[model samples]
Target chain A: MAISSFHPPQRTLMGPGPSDVSARVLAALARPTLGHLDPAFIGMMDELKRLLQYAFQTENAMTFAVSAPGSAGMECCFVNLLEPGDKVIVCQNGVFGGRMKENIERCGGIPVLVEDPWGRAVDPDKVEAAFGANPDAKFLAFVHAETSTGACSDAQTLCAIAKRYGALTIVDAVTSLGGSPLKVDEWGIDAIYSGSQKCLSAPPGLSPVSFSDAAAEVIRQRKTKVQSWFLDLSLVMGYWAGEGKRAYHHTAPVNSLYALHESLVMLQEEGLEASWQRHCDLHQQLKQGLAELGIEFIVPEGDRLPQLNAVTIPAGVDDAAVRAALLADYNLEIGAGLGALAGKVWRIGLMGHAANQRNVDYCVAALREVLSR
Target chain B: MAISSFHPPQRTLMGPGPSDVSARVLAALARPTLGHLDPAFIGMMDELKRLLQYAFQTENAMTFAVSAPGSAGMECCFVNLLEPGDKVIVCQNGVFGGRMKENIERCGGIPVLVEDPWGRAVDPDKVEAAFGANPDAKFLAFVHAETSTGACSDAQTLCAIAKRYGALTIVDAVTSLGGSPLKVDEWGIDAIYSGSQKCLSAPPGLSPVSFSDAAAEVIRQRKTKVQSWFLDLSLVMGYWAGEGKRAYHHTAPVNSLYALHESLVMLQEEGLEASWQRHCDLHQQLKQGLAELGIEFIVPEGDRLPQLNAVTIPAGVDDAAVRAALLADYNLEIGAGLGALAGKVWRIGLMGHAANQRNVDYCVAALREVLSR
Candidate 1:
């Protein structure tokens, strides 16, 4: 049977990511399409790089958005930096770090793992020890903020540890880039990737990424070609370089990029530190409300990500049932726990445009109403 | 400097792909964002698979849109099907065909070349002879419609030849899906990938791909892990499978899928055969108009893709200047020939929503005025 046009419901998105998009971003997304190489389009692309650099807190010339989602962005970092038989130390605190291991193994790199519990942040001491054990390791990789659990690692300390070990740093900033404090330059992160949907609150297609000059050099000096042609940064750079003339790569997700551009523009307007503070402020309001409802967070106070609240599911509260009620009755969508945290916690997100008092109070009121019954 | 919201001009997109998107599809794209795992979103996704099956003219359960662009879709097919050291006959007639060879080699598959000149269809006789020489060749890969050169190959005959040799067919339908007559089941194609921006008239980002049951079986039994975690079909199918409960793969590009679903609905409403015929009809109008202006086609009439017309630049007519004037003065966009045909041909596309009498007239008139000036 032929399907007609899909009209999705206007749900209040407080999920792990894909936080509520703003009106401005949606309007920008609906703009008329442009050829990827149109002069005007190219001009917009140049502006996009400047905007992305500002959001990422990096002045790296190689910074740009990956055409796919964050997983591809992670692959771009891995494939470009690590060639066959290369040794790297990886910190696995949540789901994404495991994905990084898959990328490493697939690209013929050996991963020396520094393990952490599901809801806890990566221990920098353990990461340093892993590098110490594998002295020949050329890279140290970790997630800046684990979306599976709302745990923010100390990226500055991790990068410093890697630097001490004479290794470059690869950071997964998918859930933290626009919602929290992410200073790519100050943190000395060599390579990083973030999702457009998370914190950026654009559509869920593009992955913004950046590489330091030292990281770009690693890619240039690689002995083997990048395994995935689509994720190959060497070829991708020809198109995204934003110099005099842009080479044609794949069709840039034109409309999606427009949405991302708008999101970054909003980020710039709010000021990076201000946006981070907004998420923190809203997170505190939600926390107090949840506390009144007798909820306890899974991650420790100091290590937790303000943008993503991971609270323990109350005893015998029926996790799926409450979530279903929230969706069906309140039109509010929260996250189910993933991986090891499954059925144990509810992830409430206050990200980007969704990071405001109105959303936070609405979420708490909705949760209270749903949970009481 | 901070960039504000991007407002792309409404250009008459007559490019090779990213053909003009209609107002309905753009409106669908701007609809309220839903969580990727929202129940309503899943229902829409199920509907999407059904509509995609209608568009591809197949009943394969594996039919769905890849969250990335066409190049990633191309990689998805290659990575899933071609195991290490597999011998495949790659027919190179255009830029995409050469990309397939890169995919093959990158995946450790040996590519036996069946060379065809750019702007020409793949030769079936040479393909058969090549297969005769390499009886162990497991796959026959070729482009059904070459976007770079505006040539159309006989997919039915090519698939038949591959079937006769006990080889599977991997067809590049990136430019052929809705704008041409492509019957996946009738032709016994093992795998096919297409771009939403091409004949579907959806904004770019998603690549709709389908796999025969036999092809799916090959992926299920692969000896080695897929090189790129993002392009891995085994994991991707977990989310796109439209079953009772979905597994989390990567976040689906929610908004882009909405646009694709709308485009498929429009195709279904118009009727597939009618849409194909409409493109052909518009091509006739464009062809006659271009001929009046003494514009000669790069591909022979018999082998040309009606949706994309590759015409030679008039003698001493500066290619870049004419295109620039067309864009600046008339707000029209056309494709310049890529790879071997660059600077020699202007690819005039009558694709999807852009394939209409009004657009054809505007394009020809714009060219005539630009050239006269």
Candidate 2:
């Protein structure tokens, strides 16, 4: 019954999510507990909103972190916005896009899917054609950066097309938000959701989401109540938004929000453009290193996300074995391909706090050694 | 855009969770992130499962923390265990119990109610009567510790009665697990869910849940798919349980598990019996002090939970003013009444590391001073 201290092995997290959390964010996670409704914590909550707005590039006013991870964020958007029998168009290029389809179907909405090949960006023309065919579609859902495939879709164009088709847009910015360019307002996105762990480099468990006035109006006019009461943004908004009289929903995750606040602060300090550039620069460095080692990327140069690098497994190399060896030998962690790409690709992420010159160099060198062995 | 260092006010957290996290757990929270699938982290996950099993007092192999809060944990249990048209008898005493009903109804199940007054423990006889009337009821669900009322129910007796009727039991032990005696296996409970932030004193992200083999069998025999693919325990168990291999689930929260592991270690060091005794002793001291100040209890003595003390609001005392004074002037927090008891009672929580002689003294002295003003 002796209390053993937790001793975690330090690893360079270059995976899709839970990207290496900064020490400052970790310290924030260690902040002394505050009551969810304490004025001081409320003040922190307000600052967190402003920071989230800055990170998401939206002034939607209904922006806050869902108490769960990114998948719940997706559920929140769908459950709150789309009622039963609503027709929605889901553009699927990777795992997250398919999740959106699942969410739409789960909400009892009809999903009009526009399929794209894995490891490729969602084609705006294909989406436009889908919308043209299904003119009654109420919303357009797509992944901005598909973590499963390391492809960055053209969200700006897709949202524009959806807007033209009189459809609200729901973008999955889970893996893209902090590491790439995402203009939620300028792109006319109606609703967007992102995770804290991926590009935000906080521990997973808070999902940041923003709803445009249009999306909020749709929620306001819902004929049926949101089926899942917990993810209902209407009740959640009363707690997350407002001046003084915030209604109690459930207990807010205080320390996780503190970590998120610090992570956003770090993101703001680095400046979004600079952070995006850093990811690009480090990804280029990694790409050059991998190219030198005779590795080919699954995603082509033009469509690949700087945050996630998907490489085709070489003929003689074992994808799982290489990842395992990297984890064991160098304490460097990366992601394996998911779903269709499973065992076919290795995902090397240079994301958020870990997207730096040294880590790119280190990961490439480590992969080379593991591949050779 | 400057990276400001995070400086958290050192407040005494006496409100409902996130209760005062100990310094040791806070240090554990700041540990480096590890890959969820990393061998070392998987080792931690294994240890975490064992510790949670010890805490829940269940030998169920299907035990682990859901990568979300208590609410999602509630969703997981209901979504996984109940299929479409399943009849569940929900004993509603407070908000969380209402949430269980919501979870059941959302999963396309029928909710049979056994209503209790908000501030009272659920009547086992009422539950039995409901079961007798609705013979198709598949399970009995209730909150072990009604946080809204600070009332404790007889989970053991309820579970025993359910077992006699050939029904399973789902217990919401969110606020009860560590602070009170939760004999999951001994009580014949089928499934139980708890929060990390309550008595475990970790940050509020992970939810510890355990399912008996009987409940697991029900999940295995489900005729329809669980609506929530993310929370489907069948898939989650493949990742959280078993040996040698783990299928992909969502990325687990790494550092949060580290903190949870440390908190459970702390829990074991104190021993469950000692921890329960400490809570009871602190509650008695607080009761004596509050009685000295002419305060009366909301629930009868035997039915009240030791960790959550609900006191009737004194006449001529501004509930908001006293709570604000405690928070703003003394950096102390106390919970406000919820639901029907709102403005009629004050819920003061002395949970996890917060349940100690010194905290009880400080909280009493602070309340006395604030109330005197």
Candidate 3:
């Protein structure tokens, strides 16, 4: 069967992730494929690690991108840190939290989930209670920003509580890194994972993750081997974190890493704090415009992720139809509510390069037209 | 902290994998990033599956590209197929085979290894004997082309032996897919994985994998969940195999898939057999030139992979120095030996788009110049 080269339609990506990759990042992806171990590529990898440390606001020394997407990043944390029969106190606020539970279970770890409402942040009180109840829980895991519901949990507080209990904290920063104020080192996050597509505005595939020294020490002392040979950090770090001579773990996604590097470089140029403010500023603009259209956010104002706005779908409105109209009429894309929130909300994203006045105006106008129809 | 956009040096990649990606594929990589669930993107995914099917020469409906590298692809096969305590007759002829064993143990499956010398093909007799010794062995895994040592095993013979033993066969076709003859359905291979970087002329991220009906059945009937949350075929299939409404799994590497699609399209235009012949013909050219420079093939001639030339470094010539000079003076990248052959051999790749008369001539000339020094 003869098939031609694919030319994807240009859509204004205002979805949960993969939000409007800049021309620079896309161009970087098209650069010549390099050998994974090439000195020049290795040099670029070092720069990439430094940039990731900057994005995550950490100097953890173990920050690097997982070869796969954010889902794999979540798995990386669980598999490396938890052996069979290990206990973790996990907080579930939205879709990603449930996914974390899956990862924990798949790692053969007992997950004592501290449940919360879908659009609400992880209650620090409940997390504390859960840890208090399961005093043997060695890890406390939670999402900093729930992409599914656009809720921003109190990471600093949650981490502080975990630390008080002598438990390591694994944070899912997929929707928070480079889009909001996520201070990994300051919050004392034991481990964290983020998505390149979400706030970095790179093509989806690579997952940027970081680990605290405590988490590293735990992995080092683990009695059992990490279940995933591919996601094993001990082997992975030999390739990513080594100096002078880097051991080959697997052939890295050289071109995708180039895109990630360029995206991180863009994040560097804009500056992390400025990038966070840009996302917050644009969210306010979109919020006002959505207010004019009688749309309401499902997440409360104080605990919302500015980059991912989970707004309630109007009564009697067709979720699929509205999203289709946006795509067909305006070449725009918005996320349908995932998991429990399905059909109830639309996730309008203002991430990275897409967090600008033009996209905000375009998205709001498109939504208004679609809703009017 | 200061950083600039990474402008990589233009080098001719004649390494083990990440073989020279064509301009068309690289241009496709630079194309606009589309949302993972975009209808247009879904349509592209369908075409991509068909292309992968064509490349693997399989009619299996479950064929698709894994979002990670080849190593992850290997893990996906192992985790999905083997339940804990299952016995797999694994053949180790080179580096990837050893990696497969690691994956087997990580999945809690017992790997009964059938060994062969590193630079030699996996002996089918030894594989048959292993199955004979362990009649309970239900799985047989081996690499068709050993990337580490340029040894091309007899996959057809090995699969036939496994079929005789009533075992499912898993084949690693990473370095063999487009450059050499590989017929998945004809060989009755149950599960096979290949990399986009090798012979496919794509960037080094995606791994194209196919599962026969039998392999798919094994995954379906498995009682335990696949240990890898990211690599689980059951959940992964919901996203990849769905016709109308694709379930969101992980965000696929969108732009990288664009490059993979374009590379496969180019493979389609140049028929698979013709491409295989081109690699073989170029190998002959490179072989003759290497012989002129007093270099000897490490693997016996017949067993050697045409796309990857594993030749002995000239006596008294420094392996690092020659490879370094090739990069420094000629802007050429040939792979240094891996594992057991580390300092003894150089892996000169003639794979995919790099399998041309000019590249063969350039690589041979560069090696000759460095060796003479």
Report the TM-score for the A-chain of model 3: 0.99
Query: lDDT at B295 for candidate 3?
Result: 85
lDDT of 2 by residue, A97-146 (tens): 88889888878899998999999999988998998899999999999999
Residue-wise lDDT of candidate 3 within B1-373, one digit each (tens)?
6999998988899989889888998999999999999999999999999989999999999999999999999998999999999999999988999999999998889999999999999998898789889999989999999999999999999999999989999899999999999999999999999999999989998899999999999999999998988999999999999769999989999998999899989989999999999999999998899889888999998899999899887778778888889999999999989999899889999999999999988988888777777
Candidate 1: stretches off by over 4 Å: none
RMSD of model 3, in Å?
0.8
Q: Compose the digit string of candidate 2's lDDT tens values, residues B105-137.
A: 878889998999887899999998998898778
Candidate 1 residues A77-145, lDDT tens each? 999999899998999998989999999999999999889998899998888778778999999999999
Evaluate all candidate structures by whole-model CA lDDT and list the values in order.
Answer: 0.93, 0.88, 0.93
By TM-score, is 1 or 2 better? 1
What clash count goes with each model? 0, 0, 0
Interface RMSD for model 2 amounts to: 2.1
State the lDDT at B58 in candidate 2. Answer: 86
lDDT by residue for model 3 (A242-296), tens = 7779999999999999999999998898888899989889999999999999999
Q: Is the docking of candidate 3 incorrect, acceptable, medium or high quality?
A: high
lDDT against true structure, model 3: 0.93
- In candidate 2, stretches whose alpha carbon ends up further than 4 angstroms from where it belongs are A1-3, B1-6
Q: How many backbone clashes does candidate 3 have?
A: 0
Candidate 3 residue spans exceeding 4 A from truth: none
